[model samples]
Target: MPPRSDSDNVGFLVADVTRLLRAEMDRRITAAGLELNPGDARTLSHAARCGSVRQNLLAERIGVEAMTVSSSLDRLEVLGLIERQADSVDRRAKLVHVTQAGEAMLESMQPLAAGLGAEAAKGIAPADWQRFLDTLKHVRANLTAARDQLRKENAAA
Candidate 1:
């Protein structure tokens, strides 16, 4: 095969990094007795940060489909880790808020997760570290823009 393009190489690198990071996070969280599947943990974390996000917005923020978010929320609510409340402004819309139990779990998981992130970035020069962050942000923005464009086109169609 011809030499890979920059985009191809970057795609492979991103996949590799994502897998490694996810594995590490899963190990740490499992060790802490969280027992959360990746999706549940991610949803809970988002709820923790956003206070109470609209169901659709929470799905978008976590990069999952609305149905997936709803299912995850169902499990979380059943486990007493989250609660859904009617949005006063839009009675039709529901908001997801983490329960006290969820907050405590998130707080307990913070130190291990934060330390893992720090260790992962260790030894990089400050300038290079900054650039790495910027590049990742740029990639995410590009993907988000592309996704939005596609959504608009689909709606038009």
Candidate 2:
């Protein structure tokens, strides 16, 4: 078989879309002269959405490296966007929460994010759009399960 094109592969297509979305978000933040970059915005957004989540869990949910999330959180904390408190159950781990300032910032960014989503789905009908989103969520759940199983198998080996 001839070598496959990157645009024709599921993994490559997903990565391309993700890169485009993030790049647009980065551009909007920079254009707005926001103090935080895309990385910090994402970290803060996740914290606000998840509500007092463990750092590792937030990193896992965001699909980023632990150090990447940690670095973002550090910058966000300095900017008063997020705060890390000692986890009550896990002594070694910290729980991250978005501050009021973070929420305000997120409120300001929400319109931009919604606009991006709308732009991404511009030509799609409402029914198809919801179905597509549902499909993506299902695919994500399956992939997460597969990843967890792989990790368990690797640990056992």
Q: Which candidate's TM-score is highest?
A: 2
TM-score of each: 0.74, 0.85
User: Residue 7, candidate 1: how far off, in angstroms?
Assistant: 9.7
Candidate 1 structure quality by residue, lDDT tens digits, 1-157: 8975675588788988888987898788777777677678888988888887899999988888999999999999988999999999999999888889988878888998888878888999888988999999998999989999999999999
Candidate 2: worst-modelled 10 consecutive residues by lDDT: 3-12
Model 2 C-alpha lDDT per residue in residues 94-156, reported as the tens digit of each score: 999888999999988988899899999999999999999999999999998999999999999
TM-score of 1: 0.74
Q: After best superposition, candidate 1 residue 130: deviation in angstroms?
A: 2.3
Worst 10-residue lDDT window, candidate 1: 3-12
